[model samples]
Every structure is written in C-alpha cells, then in structure tokens.
Target: MDVAGIARIATEMTDFSTKEAVGIAVLKKAIDINAAGALALIEVIPDNSQSAPNLPLNLGRNINTIA
Candidate 1:
C-alpha cells in the first residue's frame, strides 16, 4: 500500500531471515559438539574382548538360573 508500510514489512522480513539464519548456525554448532562428545566417549571405552581371548567360548553362554 503506502511506502512506509512497505518499508516496515521489508524490515520485518529481513529481521526474520537473519534470526532464522542465526538459529540454523547455532543448531549446526550444537550438533558438531555433540558428535565430538560421542566420539570421545567411544574412544575411551576399554577393549576388553581382546584381553581375554584364551578363555573358553562357552564360559559366558550359560546363565545361573537358580536363585
């Protein structure tokens, strides 16, 4: 309609676009941080399977059902 109203709408649209871009950037950063943390956790896990290879294969297969 009027030039002032058009200007206000354009400004509001620009503000919304900027906010949306910042939100997306923040989300990507958060995802990257979480992935790094997960990788760190995976790296810290002890590799116990290799430590006791000589044990019998059936050792852990049996469950003691008698309470």
Candidate 2:
C-alpha cells in the first residue's frame, strides 16, 4: 500500500480511549514505507556501488527491529 493509504488506515484505526492499536499500526506502516523506500533507493544506485545488494536487507532488518 502507498503511504497515503497507510496513513489513512492508521488514522481510522485510532480510538480515543486506547492508543496502542493506533500506535502499533502507525509504527508498522512507517517501517513498511521505510523498507520500500530503501529498496527503491537501492534500485536507483549507480552500477558502480558494490554494496548495493545488501542495502535492502539491512534496511529491512533495521525497520523490522523498530517494529
């Protein structure tokens, strides 16, 4: 899903009495978005970048850790 869609879902999932659901949803969505963005960045890297292959995996790990 796109960032806007994720944001909308996060907003809709929120309840005034309990913030945990909303917080978790938002955090997960943010991590997903970040991972996607990191992959995109890796794709756009110049062919000379030798470490490009590991970028997405590292980013995924970092984002997962956050979630």
TM-score of each: 0.75, 0.44
Candidate 2 residue 64 Cα shift, in angstroms, is 36
Name the Cα RMSD for model 1: 3.2
The residue-by-residue lDDT of candidate 2 on 1-67, one tens digit each, is 8999998877777654258867889999999999999999998986633656756544533345564
lDDT of each: 0.91, 0.75
Instruction: Tell how far residue 34 is off in model 2, in angstroms.
Output: 0.6
Query: Clashing pairs in model 1?
Result: none
Candidate 2 local distance difference test against the native: 0.75
Model 2 CA deviation exceeding 4 Å by range = 1-17, 49-67
